[model samples]
Target: MSLASTSLEYIAYFSEIVLAIIIGLAVGAVVMWIGGYDPWQAYYQLFVPSLTTPYGIYMTLSFATPIILTGLTFAIGVRAGLFNIGAEGQMYMGALGAVLYGAVSLPFFAYLPMEFLTGILLAVLWGFIAGWLKAYKGVNEVVSTIMLNWIAYWIVETMRVYVIPNPIDASKTVSVPPSGRLPLLIPNTELSVGYIIAVLAAVLMYFILWKTVIGYEIRVVGYNPTAARYAGINVRKVALYSFILGGVTSGLAGVCEVAGRPPSYAITTGLSNLVNLGFDGLTVSLVGANHPLGIILSSILIGAMKAGSRNMQIFAHVPLEMVQTVQGIIIIALSVPGVVRLIIRRIRR
Candidate 1:
């Protein structure tokens, strides 16, 4: 019975995903038509080669790495009964932590662990401030997190201008040291050990959230705070723990963006550098049904969009907003399970 129920759940999950994608595509097609673009050609150009070619695959994975970590951040927060909009701030702080530690000299092994931990710790503290405020002072997590994003953004931008501008390019920070960078998995590709790191983090989250006592407490608290309190679970502590854990993963995203991409070493150099990853994570988490494994697959799809959207205009003159429109429709379609269920019911009937 349990196995049958599980299989049924999996089927439903896959069904929602497929339906959401189709709806998203349908909406995207209408938008393309209105915008005077060929939807078929646009989508074909946008998706066909993303994973079919070597460079495309590498770029797709590279795009997936950070968002996967951020998706985990958001998904875990959902499980903990909190809406953590502060992953953006936590991500920035994490990158700052990497930069701060990279400035120092240490052994190869020591530098790697130390710098990565620094990112996690910094993000934890950033999250701790908001979590404590929410748990104790009655502050709203959404407002606090949004404010924190701007605060961290300007803080980093200010520091960029006055504190750590690169000697060669005053626009960006100094390069990360060789000891701190993640080695490439494939030669001459952007793919790095960050992919491995992200997968490991996902597995660990699944175990911690599903297979452990603490995870049980967190989920219980998320499901019903009042009940969990009556049951003697420390709701406040669990809230703090959830925020910190979310921050840790988001921070790791920032770290990977910094340390995983060598030679560049500077987050500022890239356009939209270290930005929107947290927002993208929210989309990814929702698309993945807030499951760790789901986030991995969702991130890949979104990543493919990211890598392939670049050529949309070149091949079909489809504006980049076309992709955003599809993603937004997908998120909206999935956000309300009622709609998905209704569609599924009609199909089954």
Candidate 2:
């Protein structure tokens, strides 16, 4: 496609996303009004504080950190024509890998890098199972990934409670060593350099997808596997690569959550800090139109909603569930245009 056409396509997609946001907010307002709450006040509490205040923005970005990576996991899969949802399981493995960082002492320079390497390696291995199965045995990725998620949850949970249990807390894994932990970007806040890492990862992904040869192959396979194969692209390799890449990002997210986030800096007994992060990324990926750069902006928006939801409940008397409902509505609205476009594409084909 020509550059101008590509630009136009992006603009159109952006416009559609904006419209979806408007429709979702309008619908949410109606729902709030019907429930006897002041919609305007609820929205004000939901957004203004988070967007306008420095502290709130930092919190929002901190929250956005992990999801940003996980969002990339999902987005990369979609680009490769795969519905790889193994990020949840992969993230679990990643966290466990980071937890291993506390098990042994190392030099300062090696400590942090080892933590990242181990976490990413474990997540990649976990993702490999599903990828190999799908590529070689034709196993359904969705089912395999779902089962793997549960397995990862239990495995990580057992390990956290047994092998890596914090000696003092007994409810969470051992904390990352000081050298391994990401430095805080803001004093006394969860904001850390992890946010910067996430942004850089997004930028890296954009470069890969738009400018690299392998990325072009992945996109080609996604656009049409048969055509890709006929054109001499290794379809199976691309599929496997996509899953491995997903694992890389998801694992990074897990590492960041445990090593970067404040307070515990460890996985809890129930994996509370890491739970639902992968699924939430699915929403982020969709809202961002499965684009890496777009995911950054979308993650912030989603993160803001999460940060503000508490304020909405406390100040506006809006139920937290209501905020969640609005998010669901937004996701549905955002998905509609993509679904329609997909249908149209299929019809044309």
Candidate 3:
């Protein structure tokens, strides 16, 4: 494509996302008006406090950390022609691996690396199961991953309750040891080095996908597996690589959540702290056009909304469900273009 054409395409793509945001906000405003709330005031409270304050920015980045990694997982799968929803399960395995930190004693440097390695390996194993089933056994990845997710959930739950329960508080798993905990990036805030690491991971993914031979093969396979094979690219290997890379990133997400998040550095028996993050990442990935760089921006936006929801409730008296409805509307609107493209491709095939 010519430079002018490429520029035009970029403009159009961004314009679509902007339009979707407008539509979502307009619809949300109408909903708020009907609910007897001042729409303008509600929106102001929802955005300003979260975007304009230092503490809010810190919280937003902190919340953005894990979702960024999870979103990368989904984005990688999409780039490799897979609708991999296995990040949830892989993340569970990763969290379990990180939880081992509380079970063993080690030097600070060794402990941290061990936690990350263990988590990534376990997550890769979990992802490999689905990848193997799809690549070799011809099983549908969607079905396999869905089943795996529930299995992972139960396994983690069992471990939390029976094996790693905190002696001081049985409702949660044992806390990460001080030596294993990530240092706070900002004083008196949940923000930690995890956000920085997440951003670096995004940058690394960008390099891998846009500037590497393996990435070229993966993209080719995604574009057309038959064509990729005809071009001498091993389609099955690309599929496996995609899943394993996704596993690495999602595993990091789980490890970060357990080791970086404050006041709890531990998994609750209910898994409340880690629930739905992987699913949320799917939304983030779609909104970001399944690009690593875009995902970083999208994650921050979603994180801001999450951080600001409390302010909306406290200041505007908007109900939590109402705020959630607004967020859902926004995400669905943002996702429409991606969904339509997928449908078009499937129909053509």
Q: Using Cα atoms with residue i matched to residue i, what is each candidate's TM-score against the true structure?
A: 0.90, 0.94, 0.96
Instruction: Report the lDDT of model 2 for residue 121.
Output: 97
107-219 per-residue lDDT for model 2 (tens digits) = 97787899899999999999999999999999988899999999999999999988888899998999998899999999999999999999999999989887999899999
Candidate 2 has its poorest 10 consecutive residues by lDDT at: 340-349
lDDT of 3 by residue, 1-349 (tens): 5999967966777788889889988999999999899989988887887789999999888888999999999889888889999999999899989987898878877878999999999999999999999999999999999899899999999999998889999999999988888899998899999999999999999999989999999888888888899999988899999999999999999999999998988999678999888988887787788899999998888888888899999999999999999878877888887777666665654
Clash count for each candidate, listed in order shown:
0, 0, 0
Off by over 4 Å in 1: 1-7, 269-271, 321-349
Clashing pairs in 1: none
- Model 3 segments beyond 4 Å from truth? 1-4
lDDT by residue (1-349, candidate 1, tens digit) is 3999978987787787788788878887887788788989978877877878888888899889999999898888778877787888899988887876545677777867877898999898999999999899989998999999899888877777677777788768876788788899888877899988998898899999999988999888777788899999998899898898898898899899888875576658432578899888887887777778888988888888878887676877776677677656655665555335434543543
Show the colliding residue pairs in model 2: none
Q: Candidate 3 at residue 39, lDDT?
A: 87
True-vs-predicted CA distance for residue 183, candidate 3, Å: 0.9
Quantify all predictions' global Cα lDDT against the true fold.
Answer: 0.81, 0.88, 0.89
- Best candidate, TM-score-wise? 3
Model 1: residue 155 alpha-carbon error in angstroms = 1.1
- Candidate 3: deviation at residue 50, Å? 1.3
